[model samples]
Target: MANHKSALKRARQSEEKRMRNRTVKTRIKNVVKEVRSAVAEGAKDTAAQDLNKAKSIIAKAAKKGVIHRKTASRKISRLAKHVNTLTA
Candidate 1:
């Protein structure tokens, strides 16, 4: 229960941000899963494509403050490694 008007506005903003962040996080997870599944299926081309898409999504999430920059970099690195391994 927000007593002040400003507090109520803040609460609303927080809830909106939370929902947006949740969606972004879910999207990130789904993209990562897609990349992993492609790799597991031995589809190097598909995996690489998915990795690129994932990298972009992760970077945007980091830029938007949904996730940490280092975390995004780590995710991109790992996905790239998997794609590379598939190619190699």
Candidate 2:
């Protein structure tokens, strides 16, 4: 329980931010899974498309401060590598 008024307000703001972040993170996970599944099924075209979508979502999350920029870049790089393997 927040004793002070300011503390209660801060708690409320924190809860809102947490929910927003959770939604973004869940979206990121779902897109990444989609990309991975496409890759696993050897659907290069689908994987590539999903990878692009994942990259955009991840980058947006990073820009929104939901995730670290480097972490987002790393995730995008890894997914791209997997999708590229289909080309090789």
> lDDT per residue, candidate 2, 1-88, as tens digits?
9999999999999999999999999999999999999999999889989998999999999999999999999999999999999999
* Predicted model with the maximum lDDT: 2
Q: Residue-wise lDDT of candidate 1 within 1-88, one digit each (tens)?
A: 9999999999999999999999999999999999999999999889988988999999999999999999999999988988899867
Q: List the residue pairs that clash in candidate 1.
A: none
Candidate 2 Cα errors over 4 Å, as ranges: none
Q: Candidate 2, TM-score vs. the true structure? A: 0.98
Per-candidate TM equals 0.95, 0.98
